[model samples]
Target: MRIAKVEAFWLRCPIPEAKQHRSDYGLLTAFDMTLVVITTESGLQGFGEAKAAVGSSGVCASIVSCVENELAPILIGQDARNINELWERMYNGVRDHYAIKRGRVFPILGNRGLTVSAMSGVDMALWDILGKSLNVPVVQLLGGAIRDRMEAYASGGWAGADAIGEQLLGYTAKGFKAIKMRVGVMDETVDYSIERVKAAREALGPDIKIMADAHGTFSVPEAKRFCRGVEDCNLYWMEEPISPDNKKGTAEVRAMTTIPIAAGESEFTRFNIRELIELSAVDVIQPDSAIMGGITESWRVAALAAAYQLELAPHCWGSALSFMAGVNIAFASPSAVVIEFSSGGNPMMYDLVEEQIQAVDGQILAPTDPGLGMTVNWDFVKEYKQ
Candidate 1:
């Protein structure tokens, strides 16, 4: 079958007030999602999502327009089965001389990041289509899964130290052996960050693992001091201690702290990952499925990380769509330590996905269905569609 048409929908769904979390990118407020639907000649279609900002329904519209008006024509008559080749062609088609030079500007694609995000949506849909066509799950296409489940780190403690401590204990009580908390937002005080990590350690006890994310909000000195201060906490990893693109900053942080440095969510493509890995910039690699070229590219990132003996723990920050996509990658990954749950405390996640992804005690069960396993609630999709 050949790709016939591609359509994108910008959906803005109103989230319940009670369900809003501090980190709910848009859950409490109306949030926008760019959903891409690729139709084939035989009438089979697959769905995917792009990383749209909250209330950026128009951005989603523009992305869909780019795919339908610009990229779809390039693929309409092409064989739908050559997923990888098609992905390369799509990449090269837009990675014009300008994108090659400025890195932000592309000749065919006006914005590089948006173009990558849009392309990721399309690539994910193509994989979904291919998996559905083969009557197999995406993991099967990626050589089957190695593990039955992934360990989950309770990803958020946003309510403050006490609240976060309670959350960590909740995960521990539930049997999770590890949890990750957002740092660097704590007044930029190493003392404050250290106290937060210490509080989590105190609440969870010694055996449980704790990780912290600086969220690219730390200055080099603060990160260095914070990493050193928390060295005794035995943090599983210190994530994005500095900006993702600041290789020097990350390297300095990595050198200063015995704690493992984790990064890569903001990064795109295998090229960035290769450089990060080669430089040993971070101890763990965090490639997000939605932001890092979807599954096609993240799998490559995982592979490259494996080659370098680095850990792969995806940075999950979007809706359930992106979360499930991350699950597929983790399922097939050998070096992945834990899949991050946006402990952002948002209900859009629980609302958008029919299958609730709760960690039983501490580990997440692998999705058993084909493609991304979990099905999207289109009714919810419709409600949220802008």
Candidate 2:
């Protein structure tokens, strides 16, 4: 069968409390989720969501435009079963051919950011279609799950110390042993970040794991200092302490501190992930399904990380669709230690799916049904559609 119609929906979901969702990047005024639906000739629908960075309206718009104007024109009429060909088409269309024209001296500035986000959504929807065509779970189609039930870290640690204390208590009470918190949002100072880490450690105690995310705000020296300061907290891992672009700087920070550095949620291809692995920039690889070309490319990343013996904690920040996509990857990979479970800030996450996955006794039970198991709540979709 052929892929017929490709639709993109932009939903600007608001955060519950305005002050609660602010991060190092900026305040998450409203979350923008771009959903992709690929309809086959037989009338089966496959759904996907783009996990754009918080407060990125332009990027979100770019994703919708890329899918509608760029990707759909090329993807529509293509064989629905030929997933590899479709991915390669999107990849080259964005990153290769369109990027470098004859007289052009340089490639496009933000093609990786804008073009790939759109491509990723399409890729996910295509995979969902593929899984549904053959009656099997996406993880099974990927050679079955290495893990039946996956463990997850509570994805919070926002606001300040007092909020963090309460949040951590709530997460642990819900049986989350590992949690991630924002570090560089409030204060750029190493001392302030350290205090946050210290407070988190004190609240969660030494047994529970605390992972701090700088969100790529700090410079090399500042990131190093912050890592060193929080080294005493015995964190499980530190995520994106510096920018993802600075490979040398990331490696230097890794050399300076014992905390395991994690990054690559912003990166979209296996080439970038391979570079991160080869450079020893990140100890744990966090590739987001929605942003990293969905299941196909994310599985490639998982293989790459496995070859290097690096940990894979699939970065999840979008709707339930993308979270389930991440879960499929987490289930299929032996090296996957934990997947991100959102808390507090993301309203779209809670409202997007029929049944949201939750942790029980510190482990999340992944979806075992056919496709990515994404049963979208279309009522919420219509209500929040931008």
Candidate 3:
């Protein structure tokens, strides 16, 4: 069918007090998400989310501007079935050009912040439309379910050492077998992270998995120190120990540490993913489906990961729409190790959707319904719309 309407809603969803978290970045503050709704000529509505982590300004407006002015005009009457073609059109439409220094050519697209974020929403909506039209779940369209249920890891917990006792107990109490906690927020030293992991391991025992996220906080040397120091903790992986773009630094950290490196949440497209893999930067790929041109590009990244023998544990940190998109990607890809479940302490996690994503005893059942397999609570979403 043909595309008829494309709309974007930007919302600033505040973190609930009970679920409030802190990290290296700062207090786990309000999150910004841009929801894209696409209405086909036949009146089918498909929803997608953009990973809209806003600054003081410009970001939310950019998301809306791109969809309304740049992309919608280009794809208004185009066939929604040509998902890839439309994706390329949108990807190529945005070009950052200037600095033409005597024969130097630079026409970049499908890379970086607002360009990819906006394109991601549109690309995702196309997949949702495609799935709804065919009456098949998005997972089926991707290649069918690879596993019966997805294993999810609880993410958060960087309040402090004093809070570790409470945090660890809370996670296990929810029956989460694996958990990831924030490090490097308190101090610039490795001592804090080492202690945090040690405490987590001590509380968790051997069977439960522990992962650490430095949030791209340390230098290469500091990362090496932290990873080696926490080696005894038997962490599942060390995430974003160094900056996301430092391929050489990441590779060096990976070489020195026995712990697996997981990154790419800050990365925007498959190109970024390719460079990371070619450099052997990470053991696991963490493509944020909402940010990286949606499920279509993430699936492409997953295929790339398979070729490199890498595991996909997608970086999930947004509304339920984005979370479910990540889940569907995990379901479809054989290389998936785990899909992050950030719903533990956040009501916004479940409030964004009408259907609940039930995770019992650390396992999540894959949704089998049509489209993205989750219904958006637009009314709730509208309440916080900017």
Reference-based lDDT, each prediction: 0.74, 0.80, 0.79
Give a tens-digit lDDT track for model 1, residues 20-39: 54431222455556777788
How would you encode candidate 2's per-residue C-alpha lDDT over 1-386 as one tens digit per residue? 79899999988876666425666556666667899999988999899877566323324776788789988988898887788777766766554443344423233343467677777888888888888888788888888888668778888777576667887888889888888888874675778888878988888788998899888888898888888788789988988888877988898889889999999887867878888877888899988888887788899999998889999998887677888898988888888978888876666677788876667888977567888887788898898887
- lDDT, candidate 3, at 153: 89
Q: Estimate candidate 3's RMSD in Å.
A: 4.0
Ranking by lDDT: 2, 3, 1
Estimated TM-score per prediction? Answer: 0.89, 0.92, 0.93
TM-score of 1: 0.89
Ten residues in sequence with the least summed lDDT for candidate 2: 98-107
Q: Look at candidate 3 and tell me the lDDT of residue 285.
A: 95
**Worst-scoring 10-residue span by lDDT in model 3:** 96-105
Any runs in candidate 2 off by more than 4 Å, and if so which? Answer: 54-59, 94-111
Top lDDT prediction, candidate number? 2
| Candidate 2 lDDT score at position 242 | 81
**lDDT against true structure, model 1:** 0.74
Q: Which 10 consecutive positions of candidate 1 have the poorest summed lDDT?
A: 19-28
Ranking the candidates on TM-score from highest down gives 3, 2, 1
